[model samples]
Target: AQSVTQLDSQVPVFEEAPVELRCNYSSSVSVYLFWYVQYPNQGLQLLLKYLSGSTLVKGINGFEAEFNKSQTSFHLRKPSVHISDTAEYFCAVKGDTGNQFYFGTGTSLTVIP
Candidate 1:
């Protein structure tokens, strides 16, 4: 089983500023990590994911994340954030066990313009 944790429940950043939403996980078996963004009244959108290969993974909207096995972390970062980036971010872990997914409470990103 795997459990995900989002360090911050809320983050407020100025427009065009760099932002990071920290995520950590604990698991007994290898798992897949994912960062998803949810817009207001919308379903979650994949921001980035770490299935295998390179530790650094990039995704849409200039978002990127690094997988650190030693630290059990997959933190999401965006060099510059826009008002449109405002949304709820979720950290998820899919365990080796079939269909077992754990999600964090979530972090709300508020971009000030």
Candidate 2:
């Protein structure tokens, strides 16, 4: 079984500053990792994913994450953030066999200007 853990429940950052949202997972077998962002009153949107090949994967809105298999971590990072970036981010992992996906509790990003 695969599970995800988000270290922070909320992350507050100043506008135009860099921010990193931590995520960790555990699984006996290889799995796919993903990051999703949900704006206020909206559904989740796929931020990025690590299927294979590159350890570093880039996503929308100048965001990127490095997959560390040894550490079992996939942390999301953005160079600079804006007020509009304020939302709840979730880290999820899906096993190679089943369609089931495990998700984290979620980290709320509040950007202050």
Candidate 3:
């Protein structure tokens, strides 16, 4: 079994400032990690994933995260955020075979202009 935990339910920031959103997960077996972004009343879009090789992964829109094995965490970070970055972020994990995924409650990123 696998589960994801998002530390923050919301993160408010000003435009063009750095931001970090915390995410953690637990699984019985090896799992794939992903970060998805969702705009208001829109579908989720894949931001990034950590499959095997690199611990540090970069995604679209200047976002990045690091996979920490010992800590069992993958935290998303962006140096500078925009008002357009305001959205809900979800951290997800998937098992080896099944496509079924476990997602975090969600983090609402409100970027102030």
Using TM-score, give the best candidate's number.
Answer: 2
Model 1 Cα lDDT, one tens digit per residue, 1-113: 67788999999999999999999999745789999999999999998889999999999999999989989999999999999999999999998769967899999999999
State, as a TM-score between 0 and 1, how close model 2 is to the true structure: 0.97
Worst 10 residues of 3 by lDDT: 23-32
- Would you estimate the TM-scores of all the predictions? 0.96, 0.97, 0.95
Measured with C-alpha atoms, the lDDT of residue 72 in candidate 3 is 88
- Candidate 1 residue pairs in backbone clash: none
Question: Would you list the C-alpha lDDT of every candidate in the order shown?
Answer: 0.92, 0.95, 0.94
Supply candidate 3's per-residue lDDT for 91. Answer: 97
What residue pairs are clashing in model 2?
Answer: none
Relative to the unseen true structure, what is the C-alpha lDDT of residue 58 in candidate 2, on a scale of 0 to 100? 99
